[model samples]
Target: MSPPPAESGYSLVWSDDFSGAAGSLPNQSKWNIVSSGPNSGNQEVQHYTQSNSNSSLSGSGMLHITPQHNNGQWTSARLECKSSFQCPAGHRLLLQAELRSGTFPANQQSGIWPAFWALGNDIRNGNNVSWPQCGEWDIFENAHGADFSLGTLHYGRGGTDHLSKGSARQTFQVESFHTWAVKVNRSPSNWQDETLEWWLDGNKFFQVKGSDVGDGELWGRVAHKGFFPILNVAVGSNFPGGGQPDDKTTTGLGSGLQVKYVAAYKSN
Candidate 1:
């Protein structure tokens, strides 16, 4: 619970330990789920299901994606990483994950967005190279019941050439299980240095140095190789605001997005 970051050298290898067997799915050697119906910014609609209400694994360790309500609309959970453990490029990656449930339904709010990401496996489909230059790494995201959460970085021409730095909503305190992280550094003095950092349960709530990424004609010199890792839960456009589902008190905000394990490290 905040002891896993070995100073700043990283070395966890890879982890999922959601135990095993529960509802099956995520363990195809490592994980490689995509089943279609994902892309979000193209326009949300909700359609990534492995069943067991989207995802499951609870022999005791945890790992659940439960967001039920299909046919009438609402099916989530999208996993990633296509081979054993990708993201080799120039090396420098550390992605962690942990989440808790309960909150969402304020007019449905678009459709309950929840995520932890990393992309760029060539971007697929003939590889024409589209979407932030086939590179994106949103450490974590929670749009709707917004109490604060985001860590973005999308490259040239994919979302208006994005770049982000975040930490708001007072920082953290949305009902436990917080250890979302990301730290990727390429190096070479500058080429933007390639940076991003976010942590709440272990402090350090924000950072995005590296001179602010792209639009200046391909940030960080491309050649990022081909990233990986991603977990999802979506439905809605602007946010949970477009799906409609608000008003179900507990402490305030309400919806779904419950996960309890996801890890990757390799910074040396």
Candidate 2:
């Protein structure tokens, strides 16, 4: 297990320990289960489900987001934080989670894509925002059982034309528990002067400044305000080879993402 991150000069603002009874659902007041299967603009094969079978709490203080294959179809869960939990500018926002993948057959974890990410809250507040223009922060993403995770930021003029800068593959075992995190320090008066950093197991691996992001106008309007957290395990998306799951190779059992806990903090 990775050591907990240093807490110097920071105070915890919110957190989910997932300490409910086994088979129970996530805390409704904090998270909303996304129940749509819309292409997700990624041509993913999984149908996001709100049922406890896909997203549930284990008696042992953890959240299990399992993906199952039924009758040649896939079902998973995507949980988004409530609007009230947005992280605003001027304050340092930090999100940390202990994550690990479930067991899998030998070399059969090819299509599994589990991600812990954040989307700008402006898009959801009826601000007439769109992808890329709204900005996206990928805290951690593991594609096709790859031994390394990718931390990236997507923002630009529009959906068709966007820019991205990512970390250089931080390696880790998929089945082993590891701490993943992203921290953003924003200027109170000027959001463009903000700095973003990514960490794996308490070590900083990537970072970028708001000024480095594409356009100043778009960055301030879309990214400066704040963002909402999202957790999901997608099966067979464009990032993982853009192919459907092979029934012969994919096993539903032990093919999920496990979260020990998730928390947010404000830096002093």
Q: Which is the leading candidate under lDDT? A: 2
- What local distance difference test score does each model get? 0.59, 0.77
* Lowest-sum lDDT 10-residue window in model 2: 240-249
Regions of model 2 farther than 4 Å from truth: 1-6, 38-40, 84-90, 187-193, 221-223, 240-242
Residue 111 in candidate 2, Cα distance off native in Å: 1.4
Q: Report the Cα lDDT for residue 255, model 1.
A: 55
> Considering every candidate listed, which one attains the maximal TM-score?
2
**Residue 100 local lDDT, model 1:** 60
lDDT of 1 by residue, 87-182 (tens): 354666666777764454434444466677777666663667777677676767775556556666566555565544444533455566677776
Compared to the true structure, candidate 1 yields what TM-score? 0.31
| Cα shift from native, residue 162, model 1 (Å) | 15
Worst 10 residues of 1 by lDDT: 244-253
| Steric clash pairs (candidate 2) | none
Provide the TM-score for each candidate, comma-separated: 0.31, 0.89
